[model samples]
Target: MNKQIALHPDLDDDLLDVMEPDNGGSVSDELSRNLRALWSTFYRNRLLIAAIVGVFMLIGLGVTMLMTPKYRATTSIQIDQQSTNVLGNTDQNSVDPAAAWQDADRFLQTQVDVLQSRAMAITVMQDLNLNANDDFIHQMGGKPADRPAGPLSLADTKREQILNVLSDGLRVDLPRNSRVADISFTSPDPRLAARVANAFAADFMIFNMKRKFGSSTYARNFLESQLSDTRSKLEQSERALLDYARSAQLLDVSGGIASSTDGSTTGTPRSLTTSNLVQINDAYAQAQAARVQAQQHWEQAAATPPMQLQEVLTNPAVMQLAQLKAQAQAAYQQDLQRHKPDYPQMQQAAAHIAELDRQLNSLATSIRGSIKEQYATALKQEQALSGQVNGLKSSTQNEQSRSVEYNILKRAVDTNRTMYDSLLQRYAEVSAQAGVAANNISQVDVADTPDKPVSPKPLINLALAMILGMMAAAGFVLLRDKFDDSVRTPEDVNSKLGLTFLNSTPMLDQEMTPDEALSDPRSALSEAYSALRTSIELSHKGGAPRTLAVTSTRQSEGKSTSAFAIARNFAKIGRSVVLIDGDLRKPSLHRLANVPNGRGFSNLLARMGSIDEAIQPTETPNLSLISAGPLPPNPAELLSGARLPELINELAERFDVVVIDAPPVLGLADTVLIGSTTEATLFVVEANGSHHGHAKTAVRRLTGNGITIIGALLTKYDARKIGYGYGYGYNYTYSYSYGQPDAPSSSRKWPWSKK
Candidate 1:
């Protein structure tokens, strides 16, 4: 006994579920597939990839050719503090070596600035005599050979240019916590670079020392002149004071007053004897009398009323009163001259005179009070002066003792002057010794002469050129790719229409009729047809498909040609194949099959002819063609009739394989009608001709009409020009044959007998 197991229809679904988790499976598969797709696309465009790489290589090469080489040299300097005698013994306690090093660093930094300054650049240029050198001028690119030189302008320009060069070529780095600095420079000429660097260091040191020495010397000279003037002035003041004391007999007055007043003097051998005391008293008394008399005279004069004549003349109130009196007197005189005293004018003048007299009395009282106060102050001052004079005469002899101390101070000033002169001489000698130029900087390493130019932007130029070239090529490729809507791969055919790829028919350079294509079946076109046959036969796993219809989305997409090719291929494989022209509006199978273009599907449908009479044999055995027969006024109506389905069913039973060449799916109902009755619909897409959207619309329209869409076949595909290389059909060449030979003749069929 035999046993059978039936699997559920959902088995495939369960297997897929087990193979992949829901979200993870979908995402991972999608990403992997997309990446694979992109990789395939890149590989397919190998020529474009090669071109891009070549462009980049050329760019690199061009850049290398245009680049220049640069050379560098470096020198180092150590800042050291040198002791000098001119620093003075006073500075010995204050000198700090660390602080001195700091100061030296700051000094060197300032010297760096000075070295790059315009003044120093001009000095260096003049010393080198660079102005007349042809080589230097030529290097500078003298636009005007005879340009006039303005010292200030030329100096500024040269300084700026040299500073720029130094900034670009030179690098100075100071080590942390160290007094040493590293200086480096890059240039075209190694020797010149080293020379300039060393010279800069030397000049900086020399300039700093000279500036210090000159400033010190100038300060010393100024101080000397000031000291001399002070000494001279002091001497003159001393002499004048001494002479005054001697003429007044004020010398020894301090001790003389003590001796005369006390009668017993200590620390002095001379005593004020009675006679000398009488003499001193007499002098003092006489001076006192003379001072009293002078004071009394001054007081008496000051007590006298001060001259009030000018006050009376210039005082506003006094002047007003006087002017009124004068005017009244003039009026009185004028009235007396003109008339009697009793006249009206004379009487008015008399009244004015009385008013003027009252004002004058008030003015005189104020002026007298001012003068009295001044006289009282003068009298008080006179008394004080008399007392001061007596005291001064008494102390005159005591002031003479200061003469000894003045002489001592004069001797000390002379001694200090001699010492200062000697120190100044020593300072000069030490400064001269320090003036000798010493190396502030030393070269750590010498740079060998460079044999190559540093820069001409070769690499940069080449890179830019290559980048631009690639950009331009990509732009062209993108532009061309954008406008093209052709199918180029099996994925294009399958994914564009949500259909399985039945086969891909590569194009042939040479032309062959349908009959010849079947006989010589080793061609690429024949091989593609065979692939199509295989894909069609394997579409439905259950059983063989009977009627297959080939159609397109638009006219002239080679649906009829593909149908004829497929029918010939099937016939060659010992199958009875019939080619039917289902495109009633525009029949093409008759032309492709080289038969009469009349009495095809339309004639049979309209009952004008029988199906057998309509069917015509082609040059190839077992392959037949059905022409469109006659033009139908309403192709859609005829195709939709019940007779069409009955006719397709009958043909399926009669022929092993029936290939229908239907009209384009869009803009016509004939393809839909034919598709409804067909066992399978094969969508024929022309490579690089039919839009992807159009192919999708055709599949959608056929499937919507309950037609079983078997798969897709790409027709007229140019494998070589699709971008990468040829398709699989032409990858290798081999030979094969199909179909069974006719039965042997009756005479030969009887036993295996030789004639």
Candidate 2:
């Protein structure tokens, strides 16, 4: 019985069962996720993937068309080493027991070895007449007349060659957990293949049959001599058993007990004595059962109260007295209801009731006394039967003691007869087996003529090639995505590096002039820069930064270009923006604008030039450029002077917004020094080229020097490269097309591929 516990009286138990995690559900979820990731990768490189798979398919087709097709024929045979001849003798004098056939693992494996042996190959080679066939000899890597240069004859070497051909073409397959085996042969000729396979099976079965016949031959010779000796010994044992039974007088050879002429009891003294005891035991059990039933009746009557006892209640005298008392009591009750206690009728009725009660008590005592007499008689009978059973038990034991010698004589006769019968049965079986030979191994299925070649399964090979080719291509695509650390999307700058996304500037065609691509209001480059300017203006929680320093972690990150783009976009929006090139070591602004670089910020900062002459106007409405003055011997020293801060303050006053393109922040103090004097700083991160750690470190450097970092700008972002086609609204070429459509090469920093 199970104990049931109630967690909650009204709650359903099945609710608790559903709370456990299901392993099947979790495994299905994991498989689904893997498939989805693979599909995404395949879609992003669909063209590349298709190209790889097509190449593999072509190779598969080539292999099928050019390769040799081989045909296979199979023959099956069942070799049951476990079904050995039962009558095969193992006696020491008959046959050596060590040579006995057994149904063990070694026996079965030995049978398979026989089918795969070189001896079998030699037989097949000779039967098939393969030596005369030049094709077969050449397939063995030899000419028909060629022979190994050794101390062997030519015929011996040719025999080795023929055997090698047979062995090479043979394919033996043993399926798991079975005694049946397949012997298959492959060749250019399908008929030869079939013939060889059938020959192998037939020869093996014929050899196994000869082994069985030999065993029978040995058994017939051995059993003839053994049978005579067994018959004589059986007769001798039978004679000795009969003589012992007659002498002991315990048995008769006629299947009846030996008796005296006077007919006195003589069959078995112990059996006759035990028979009488058995009768006495039956009578004793009967008497004991009767006594137990009587005793139970007596116990029931004695345990009952006299008034409630059946015998007492049903007694004639007691019943009469009880009826009289009940009538008198009723009469007295009637008198009490009608008359006073002193009335004559009331007194007389009370006297009658008292008299009847005395008589009932007397009758109850008589009934109980009679029941006691019955119990006493039953107990006496039980005692007498018990005594009789005990006396009979003693006599049975004494008789058993006297019959010990007779029982020994009888057992000897029985044992001898049983052994003689068993020997007779075994002799009959062995003699019959010697007349016929039986083999356990049989050929179940003959080798069939194959209709087609088994190899070069073109459809299956093509399917597998397609699958494997896709896997290899997909692996390469995923591996490239995994190892490429450059930022390819806006998420790389904001989400991964913990910064704000300002913009993603597009790279235009190299042949196009920078004026139309950067300044056109409708072009993607101009629109992207316009969005970047808006983000810059919104960087401040209060308003846009008045004076902001723009820089990057390393060179060629488009930091200066982004700074100029922002200035030009602001100038288009009717704001005066002054652009300063702070990188004295490698000034690019002047070279880009075809402006004179002789007297610029270097002279102005060195106290030899005026700020007005150093600043130049741009093509845009409200933008001006201050190119790096001639390269200073000490660029860091010139920028570190106190006049640099005052010069920026003056430019801030002259222009509505001053956008200074500082040197790269990493490995240089120029950006840090300029940013410290500016209102805020904007870090430029080139998509897929800027290292995540480099951008993070640049922000930390700027913030460490009390420089306010508005956010980061993502430059040279290509939507197609990062698998954001559907998620993002535009491709790189469509986003930057200036009235014509063509995909442009990526312009981000390709540092690893650079010299």
Candidate 3:
């Protein structure tokens, strides 16, 4: 017998899958298995998916109903290819109309930008009186926010926010390849929307007119200022000229620099008196030039040496005589040094030198007289020029005196006349332009009241809601499936529990008992149990397992029914089977079979009754059952007794198969004690009831007690639901054949095949 040990189901994490996967199985088999597991997950979570989708759809419907509606109004304005300037042509460099036409789209975009500007929006708001409109103010936001401490006052801050609200409703669009632009605004009231859009178009035209005629206003003011300054300057010049003429006791000239009457002047010709004075000035200037030349020559004669003079230096005779004298003197000096001073040669040389010297002195005297005569001649010429200059100056004294004040008055009056004439002309042009009353931009169309609102589209919202709901549903299902630790699929239990899948029993009717299922041998339930019996018989090497114990992680996992069904099926096949209710703590065998629980395992273990009285007959053919006898005070103590194993062996001797329905291994040691005594253990796992941790812990509990597990029985299995295979036919019962010749040829080999 296996050693009796103590362990709890939830106390270990290392007890799972001790047996590693075999290096066997084809890829096709693995694929089919994974697909089946996925199908099972979807099937189980279908309701959750539906609930999520329905809830989301309702929410979408609610939002669509409660949402506010708005009306949009658009006004069209024509953009001409070339803009006309209503202002007068005062600007020197105006834009070429041909170039402006080429960039019409750019200009159109500029208008669009202007339409969308905050400045435009503020104007529209003021025009609509939106600040004082209760509906408008309430719709934007009832009260202004507490003003931040900054440069702006509270009213200014509020105005900024109102401008933003207005801008949000404004939109401007330029139609593709067209010369027209649209100005649109949205509002809760259809009439209001139309009114606001029309107002914007009208205001844009007004603003454009102001822009075009702006130069006219500037020109009028500029001309007025210039006219005033000129009038003052003209008066000042006239007054000054008159004051000077009176102070000098002189006659008034016929004309000034410019002729004027009534102190008003224009740029015109001068009078005869002025012309005569000009002629006199010309003569005086000529005379002064002549006198300056004579003076310059006189000074040169007096200050310079006669030899340096042009007249003296240019004399050829003087230059040649001087050269000969120098040579003769040199010759005399050389002879005197060679011989006595009384020698004839020396006397001749001296006599030649004396003659040359006397000739040089005569020439020098002549050059001096020539210089003096030239000086007197230059002095007389300069005085004559000076006397003419003084005579001209004296003769024009009256005219010259009048001319000084006259020129000053004339220049001032001429400048004032020119400036006044030009300014007056500009003022006239500006006034004419200002009266033209035309602007380049003109409104082409006005907005009409809209009949339909542009928001709260119910159908679209519902469709989007449906799509979102389905996505949310799928996400939640996958999330739950991923985090779930329970074993819901056959592959999950087989892979994680490290156990052989003997057979899967379809879920039987809740109203029917296991003994009742045994009545119909050809039923799906019977066939499933039959397959399970065959698996247990072939699992052992020598022969069929004589004693098989069935148990699960916790209570109500259908272990008792599954074990009884297997035993009942065995008995139906002509094998003598005895079912023992080994779960003394919470036994359901007596109730399931409608048999009395008096004098069963607890009575027998306490030695209160004989084994013959403990055993009872069930309605199942060739099948006998023993109830849990009575609720024992301590089931673990009674199961651990040395007589328990001997009694199990005695039952095995009497029957070909002994099926023991052991207590759950989660919180008690009853299953472990029973499993150690049995020939083989069948871990009964409910389809969705057993968790990975619980099953693993239970398996470890039995294995730790040295009990060998024969295989796992997946009870209450739903075939059609999991999509593995349906019907009690070839696929569900025999889907293990994936072209492997040595395969078990049935679903039994799918989870437990070694090679």
Model 1 ranges off by over 4 Å: 1-440, 443-453, 467-485, 511-515, 555-557, 572-575, 619-622, 640-642, 704-706, 718-720, 723-755
Candidate with the larger TM-score of 2 and 3:
3
Index of the highest-TM-score prediction? 3
For 421-466, candidate 3 gives per-residue lDDT tens digits of 8877877777657744355576787899999987677889998998
Angstrom error of the Cα, residue 650, model 2: value is 4.1
Q: lDDT of candidate 2 vs native?
A: 0.70
Error of 1 at 16 (Å): 17
Over 161-204, each residue of candidate 1 has an lDDT whose tens digit, in order, gives: 54455555656666756656665556656565565555555555
**Candidate 1 lDDT for residue 686:** 79
TM-score of each: 0.47, 0.46, 0.56
lDDT of each: 0.62, 0.70, 0.70
Candidate 2 clashing pairs, residues 3+ apart or interchain: 486-688, 487-688
**Pairing residues by index, what is the TM-score of model 3?**
0.56
Give the runs in model 2 whose Cα sits over 4 Å from its true position.
1-69, 74-184, 187-192, 200-453, 456-466, 494-499, 553-557, 572-576, 586-599, 609-624, 653-656, 665-668, 688-709, 721-723, 731-755
Q: What overall lDDT, based on C-alpha atoms, would model 1 receive against the true structure?
A: 0.62
lDDT per residue (tens digit) for residues 89-154 in model 2 = 554233223334544556667888888899888777777677665767654334675666487688
Q: Which model is ahead, 1 or 2, in terms of TM-score? A: 1
